[model samples]
Target: MLDKTLRNFDIPAFQQDLINWYQANKRDLPWRRTQDPYKIWVSEIMLQQTKVDTVVPYFQQFIEKYPTPYALAEADEQDVLKSWEGLGYYSRARNLQTAVREVVADYGGKVPDSPAALGSLKGVGPYTKGAILSIAYDQPQPAVDGNVMRVFARVLNIDEDIAKPSTKKLFEKIAAELISTADPSSFNQGVMELGALVCTPKTPSCMLCPVQEHCRAFADGLEQELPVKTKGKKQKTTTYAALLIKNEQNQYMIEKRAENGLLANLWQFPMAPIDEIGMEHITNWFFAEYGVQMNIGDKAGTLKHVFSHLIWQLEIFHAMTMQTETADERIIFVKPEDLRLYPFPVSHQKMLKYILD
Candidate 1:
């Protein structure tokens, strides 16, 4: 009997309820004012696995720097990453840069209106493409983000594992059915807003929920159970060694990372895996490679940064060095005051801040 109630759901009343709520309570976000695909694309990309408040400043700064797809394509990748500092998931920043290049070279710097064409661009995955089409172009496309998934699972009282790809397809079909063709952009925003503010993950404000009457989860007192999820794999941990070398003039030595891997193209103190490393080996490597000698200082502290799949346990050590020979190596010695000029990851920022204070 409960199972049957979960099936054969109707969405018109729910849609109306959400639309009404959004008309009055929607946030005055900058991205909501314009229908520009480029702005929409940038916001959606930045919003992935990130909160709205965190993304607002980044969006403003990125737009001020890039302004358009052609501008972003022509700018340096490091500059793009620099603007995206403090935002996790470095790949999204890289992909945004790559997508800009593709948009300029292939699509003449305009985002595609059709879903298939939008999806063809680099980093414009299904969810992103749907968002752009529906929100910017007013197309009746299904943007099935985590928020919408939660809303649909509870409204229909679905217990089918929401983690499955099939569940996404099912939700997409249902969303497309509920979307008001008269104003798809409004309808899409309404549903997304409902999920974000009303049907939140914990202690949902059901009193304010627009469609509480039609929600099967509300009736059965199973709002938390309807959107069933499978447990995800635990994050893997990795160790890092940072060599905090200081020169005779009280300046620190730092290097720019290659434009790949974690925290790509950012500046940081020299680092190597410490499990198979020793102080003697580091001293030898610096002298042989860069012709610099150093007296190892005491261990300053350790910092940890967590990414989606990997965890970094960074062990930072302080050392003093004097240059024996002047060579134009890839390393730069900068005073603490000038550290802000170069872009660095949050982990490195924290380390520098700690040492400075």
Candidate 2:
């Protein structure tokens, strides 16, 4: 049993306590040091599905390379993808460039301050829009991502599935109501900070949480079980044969993925699903695709890479070629030293390590 109605509680006191706790205890993240919309926007996008420590260096490099919306808009797409190499969900990088180009062309190179205008940009969803408006502009919009949702679920002792769209909407509404008008930036960030720090998904330190006194879940001793999320579908495994074809000169062969879909435009060693394609068929297909004859060698090794929806079980094979160039436009022969410049998916990166090391 969960209480949906707002009970008579010291909401103002709760807000002050949480904000005070945040002011004293929030981690000194680079993104927190600025109100620049461009910087904040970049940080918000990079933070998507990525951990803070992992995003820090990438964020610094990206900001240095493309300091403004105009700069990012003008840069090459491949270069942008290269800059975002290791950060998975490469679509985020592509969509970010698209949205920044829109801002430069349409919004006079300025990130829109209003929720509606920001939301209209490509890949700018409710959470992103709310983040920009509230954090950058100090607007009273709720940014209810997983962290905010978890905090609210526990504070209110909510029993609904947090994975549901309706549940997210409900949490967003409650967050909007709870946002401090005087300092929406700190308030919104404070909630997320609390969730990330004290009220963590596992082993939440309710005893240390600033809002513990007002938390219904804490009062009812249900903090651990409040924010119930349904388990996602199991990822389907797919087998792949990754070809590491090298020439006599030690240049490796790579190809650009198709313009659309997963890892689009990123460079990868020629690989194919191994369902119906056998070793002999693969060697022939390689010549057909790249117009370069290869001598297949010993099995290198195997690696497993997991994406959100699928699992890639890759079988690595070493091969040699006499030709140093490719007749196919999509394929390119690059020296081992130059491979670092091309953006490779983690799966291929691992394969390269197996070959090099």
Candidate 3:
């Protein structure tokens, strides 16, 4: 029955209904108004794994700060990371700047429109490439993101795990087949709009869906169970002792993270992982790392932060170095008011507020 329905699917009618609805109902987004490939690329990257409401203000400010590819490519990496401080995913900002620099130096300051050229950029993937090409260049490429996958899962009654790579490839092919050649931009955005607004993950508004009559899962009364996705592994937790050291100059001691690991280059107070909570062990570890013995005072506070793959349990303490000096270049002393100048991870940001207050 599924095969029969698939074979008889009226691709043109479905495309037309979806696009027409999108033309009239699609939200007015900043990136939707321009044909500039650069702006579109930024929006596509910012929208990844982030909600639209959360990305709007950030998008506006970023575009205003770095109006062109050259503007962003030439800006300091620290400034770029600062702009993206609260956005989580620090790598996205770093990769975006790297990609933009390539576009400026190699691509003549214009975002490449071809798949080969665009995909070679540091951060442009298949999904992002399709979006830029279809929207900026009017190409019929498919942007198969989570929203597209979910909508198509119900449309074709596909029970394949949406989390698998094979399912995405299948959906990409299906998207390519069903895309409206005449209006690829609207068709792609329409599918995304439908998934985001009408055909939501929970309690989809089937009656209001433009292509409700054509949805296979709705016909089979399996709208709620069509998209199968495997669960990801549980997040692992780690404990750390964060040191808040203040010197005679009224400056706080902070250190930059390693240049290659998680939260690379972001600023944070001196911290080291611990097996358990103990002031003695924490100070000893600090001494080993910095070659400066420190005194552990009263406990400032404790903070728990969650990431996509890991959880952090931070035990913050009021600490002071015996020598009152950090010799490492990565370590710096910043007055309380100047701490905001450096970009710190959310976990560290919370620590600063705790100790400062």
Candidate 4:
């Protein structure tokens, strides 16, 4: 009886309650103001794994700088990365540019109104494809992201692990069946808004929820336990001794990262993986890596930055080099004032700010 009840929900009341609540209470996000697929695309991409408050200023500045796909496509990749510097997950920026360039070349600078055409984009996957389709074009497709999935898990009282790939399809299918054909835009956004606000992960405000009457988990007092997710693999930590090499000309030595792999094509201070941060170790590494000997100074500071699956523990030290000539094309010297022109990872940015301030 319990198993069958999960699938047998009041579809009309659920859809209507969500839509009516959302139409009346949805937050006035900047992205909600415009229906342009390009803006919507940019907002959705920026909002991935990021909080709405944090994305607001970045989105406004980004849109103000690059108003259209052609503007971004024609701009330098370094400049694009600079705009997305602290956003983390630099690959998303790279893939967005690649997809927009395709849009410019193939779709005449317009985002496609169809799912098949939009799904062919470089960074757009199943959820993104559905989001752009439903929100931008008002299609009845389901946008089952993590937030929407949480909403569905409790509303339907399902105990499947959301972290698994197979469970996503089940949620998507149910969402498709439950979506309002009259307003897919509101319906999808409503579920996302509900999850973010009322049906939150840890402590949901069940009494205030518009769909509280329709939530099986609320009735059974298991709202918090409905969306069962297995713990992800533990993050790997790597320690590094980063060199903040400054020359007499007020120019600092910064190196461009490799074109591929993690934080690809970004700029950073010279770093060497080592367990020690002594002056002798720093001097030897300087001569070995760049063939330029330097006077190692006091320890600048320590920084810890966390990525998706890796943590970088860095011990930064200030070093000076009178001889700045280097044979490595990847290495360049820039004044502290000009560091803004280069895109550094968040960890390096913090180190620089500490010294500069």
lDDT of 1 by residue, 1-357 (tens): 433543566656666777788899999997987777898999999998788899999999998888888888999877787888898788798898888888888888888787777898778887888889989988988888888889888887777788898888888877777787877787888878888888998888888888899888999999867688897898988787777888878788888777678777788887766555664587776666556678778888988988778788888888888752347456788988888878888888888865588
lDDT tens per residue, model 3, 274-296: 86545557666677677667687
Question: What is the C-alpha local distance difference test score of each model?
Answer: 0.81, 0.88, 0.88, 0.88
Task: State which candidate, 1 or 2, has the greater TM-score.
Answer: 2
Kindly report which residue pairs in candidate 4 clash with one another: none
| 1-357 per-residue lDDT for model 4 (tens digits) | 333644668888888999999999999999999999999999989988899999999999999999999998898899999999999888889999999999999999999988898988988888888889999999999999998889999988888899999999889887888899999999999999998998998989998999999888899999979799998998989888888888988788988999989899999998888865554576787787877778878788899989889899998888899866698888898888888889999888888875577
Looking at model 2, the pairs that clash are none
Per-candidate alpha-carbon RMSD to the true structure: 3.0, 1.9, 1.8, 2.1
lDDT of 2 by residue, 1-357 (tens): 123346665678888999999999989888888889999999999988778899999998999999889899999998999999889889899999999999988899989997788999888899989999989999988998999999888887778899899999888878877889988888988998998889999989988989999899999989878799999999999898888988988899999998789998899998877776776588787777678899888889999999999999988888899988876889999988888888888888877786568
> On a 0 to 100 scale, what is the lDDT of residue 189 in model 1?
84
Residue pairs that clash (backbone atoms under 3 angstroms), model 3: none
